[model samples]
Target: MTLDTDPGVAPQEEKLEMAADLTAAKEVAATDIPPELVAQSFGGYLRAWMARIRSGDSGVLPVLLGLIGITIVFEIISPNNVFLNTGNLVNLFQQSAVFMVLGMAEIFVLLLGEIDLSVGYVGAVGGAIAIQLVQPVTINLPWWLAIAFALVVCALIGAGMGFLITRLRLPSFVVTLAGYLIFNGVLLIILLLGPFSGYPTLCTSSCSGAQNNSHIIYQLMWGTIDPTVSWIGLAVIVALFGGSMWWRDSKRRRSGLVAPPPSLTFLKIALIAVIGVVLLLICNANRGRGVVQVVGVPWVIPIVLALLVVWMVLLERTRFGRYVYAVGGNPEAARRAGVNVNRVRTLAFALCSATAGIAGLLYAANQGGLSNNVNGGQLVLYAVAAAVIGGTSLFGGRGRALHGVLGGLVIGAIYNGLYLLGLAAQYQFIATGIVLLVAVTVDALSRRGAATGARA
Candidate 1:
C-alpha cells in the first residue's frame, strides 16, 4: 500500500491496472501476462492460473501436495495409527513451532539473495540470555524486558553481520559463516558460565510468586487457550480479516483497478473461514490421555500466526519490502533507482535475526529449558531448507512468509512421521536433504520459466 515511486509512475500504473481489469472483463486469452491481472471471471482466472503453472510458476503447489502425500503415507504406516492422532498432531505442530519461525527468519535474508549461517546459534544465544536474565542470581530483569532485550541483541548481531557484508564488500556467505562460528563459541560460554551450567529451564509447575516470570515464559509453548475463548477469538479474527479483505478488493474493483473477481474474492474468504474452523476443531478435541482433559488450541498457534501476518505485511505492503525485493533482484539496479541498498540490506538482516530470536524463545518454551545440547548447525540447515522447500528461490526476489509455514509443516511432518516409525535422526536428515534438493531443482526451473516469459 506504500508507494515508493515517482508521481508520474502512479498515473501510469493506475492506467495499466484499469486496462488489465478491462481485459479480464472480456475473458480474453492472454499470454505472458501476470496471473493476477487476468482475474476477471472465474473461468478466465482458472485458465490464467493453469497457464502460470505451465510456465513453472508453481507457487506452493508442489510443497502442499507433498505435505498431503506425506501425511497420508505416515497415517497409514506409523505404529498404532498415532501419526494422525489429533493429540499427537497438535504436539507435532508444537514441536514445529521452532522450525516454522526460524524458516520465516531465513526468508528475510533469503529474499535478498543472502544467507545467514549464524541465525540458529544467534537465536539460541537470545534464548539463553532470556533464561539467564530471569535467574535469581543474575540481573533478574522482568520477563518483558528479558524478551525485548534478547531480540534487540540478536538484531544488533544481525545488523553487524549485514554491515560487514555491505560496507566491507564481503561475501554474505563468508561473513555469516564467520558469524556462525563466533556465536557458537559465545553460546557455549553463556551456557557454561551460567548458574545452571548446562541446563537453564523455565519454572511453571511449582512456580511461586517470585518465579512468576519464569512461569510466564514457559507457558508460551505449553499453555493453551480455553476452547470457548479459542472459538470466539477465531470468529473475531476471521470476520475482521475477511471483512477488510473484501472491502479493499471491492474498493479497488469499483475504481476499475486491478483486483480479483468478486467470486474469487468470496471463495478465498470462505476458504479462510473453513481452514480456521478445521484447525480449531483439531485443537479443541480431547488431547489428554487420561482425566487431565488437555484440550485447547496451543498458544504457539496464534503466536506464530501473528508473526506470519506481521512478516507478510512488512514484505508485501511496505516500501522497505519493495526495497528488499529490488535489491535482491539486482543490487546495482536498486542503487541506481535511488534505493540505499546497504541500509536496506542491513535492516533486512536485523529483522531476520530478531525473528530468529522469537524462534529461540519459542524453542526454549517448547523444550522447557535452554540447553547447550541444541544442534544449532542442524537447526540453521533446516531453517534454510524449509524456506527453500516452501518455494523461496535461492536466487532470491521471489518468496513469501506463508511459504515458510508450509515448508515447515512439510519438514515437521517428515520428522514426526519418521520418529513415529522409530527412524533415527540420521534418517530424518537424509529425508530432509532429499526434499530440499527437489525443491531447489523446482526453483531453478521456475526461474528459467520466468526468464523465458520475459524473453517472449
Candidate 2:
C-alpha cells in the first residue's frame, strides 16, 4: 500500500520531522563517528580526549611531563640549584634557539619519513654568508639583505638536494649523506677563502652607523626587549592568540562542525595566558649580577616563538601542510589522490634546508662569529635527538613545530644542567641518547596500540 503526503501542506512540520530523523540517524551511527566529533560539551570533550589517549594519541603530554621532571631533577641536583634560576634559565633558552631551529628543519624531512644530515654544515654555510657580507669591510651589505641572501642560498641548496633525491629516485639517506660531505667541503672552502682564519665575525663594539649591520645580527642572540615594551608585546600576542582560538572554536560550533566545547576552549586560553605571564615574570626578574641589572625578556624567546608560530601555521593551516602529512603517512595513497608527491617532497627538503640555515645563523650569533670550529656533526645529531625526543615520530606523518621546540628545550636543559653539575659533554650525549631511545620506544608502543585497536 502506498500513501502520498502533500508537499505544500504543513511545510514547517516537514522540516521538524526531517530534523528529528537526522538526529535519530546520528545517534544510531554515533559509534562510527569520532568521539571528539560527537562531543558537544566540556565534560564530553574530556571523555573523548581520554579515549584518544587510550588509543595512543598522547599529544604533548609526555613532553610536558618530561620537561617538568627534568626541571625538578636538575634544580635539585645541579650545583646550587642554578638550573631553575631565572638568569640561567634565560640563557638556556638562548642556547636552545639553535637546537630548536635545527630540529624544526629536520622535522620537514622527518615528517616525510626522510632525513637531512647536511643541515648542520648547510646552516653554517648560510651563517658564513651572512657574516661575510655584513663584515663592514669587504661586502658591506645591509644586515637584512645579507640575511635574505643567506636564506635564499640555503633554500637553493636544499632544492638542489631535493631534486637529486626526487628525480634520481635516490634514497634520502644516501643523498643527504652525500650532501653532508659536499656541504662540509663547501663550508671549509668558503671559510678558508675568506679572511679571519676560517672564522668571520661581525664588527665588535666599534660598529656604528651602517656598520650597525653586524651589531643587529649580534643583537638577535644577545639583545633583550625593553621591560615596558615587552609587557605591551606580550599583551598584544596573548590577545591575538586567545581571540583566534575563541573565534575558530565558535565558528566551528556555529557551523555544526566538530569542535571542542566552549568551556574547554576558554580553559585552553586561560592556560596559555598563565604560561605567558609566568614566562614574562621570569624574564622580567633582575637576573643581573652585582650592580648590573639585566631585566626583560631575551630576544631569542620571542624569535623562537615567532618561528614556531609561522611553521605551525604552515603545517596546520595550509593545504600544503595537509599534503605533507598525507605524503608522509602514505605516499602511494597521496599520489592516487592527485597530490604532487614529488613536488611536495622537493619543497619539504628545500624548506628543511632553509630552516637549518636559520639554525646556522643562531649558532653563529651564539658563538659571536662564523668559525670552522663549529661542530656541525654534533649539532646535526642533537637536532635529530631534539626532534625525536619532542615526540615527532621517526616513522613519519605525526609531529609539530612545537614538538621540535620542546625537544630542543629538553636537550638544552639537560646540556645546561649537566655542565652546571660539572659532568662532561660525553655524559650529556649519553643522557640525550637515553632520552631519545625512551621517546622512540613510547612512540612505537603507542603506534602498536593504535594498530591493535583499529584491528579490533
Sliding window of 10 residues with minimal summed lDDT for model 2: 1-10
Report the alpha-carbon TM-score of model 2 versus the true structure: 0.91
Candidate 1 Cα outliers beyond 4 Å, as residue runs? 1-37
lDDT for position 256 in model 2: 75
lDDT of each: 0.85, 0.84
**lDDT per residue (tens digit) for residues 223-283 in model 1:** 8999999999989998999899899989987987767778878888888889899889999
- C-alpha lDDT of residue 439 in model 1: 94
Candidate 1 accuracy as lDDT? 0.85
How accurate locally is residue 212 in candidate 2, as Cα lDDT from 0 to 100?
A: 90
Per residue, candidate 2 scores C-alpha lDDT tens digits across 1-456 of 000101111122345556766777767454443443367866666666666667777777787789899999999998887888999989898988999899998998999999989899999999988888888767788989999999999999999999999999999988988988888888888887656788788655667786799878887888889988988987998799889879987998898777777877788788878888888899999999999999989887888889999998999889999999999999999999999999999999999999998888878888888767878888899898889888898888998888899899999988988999999989998998898888888889888977776555
Model 1 poorest ten-residue lDDT run: 1-10
Off by over 4 Å in 2: 1-37, 204-206
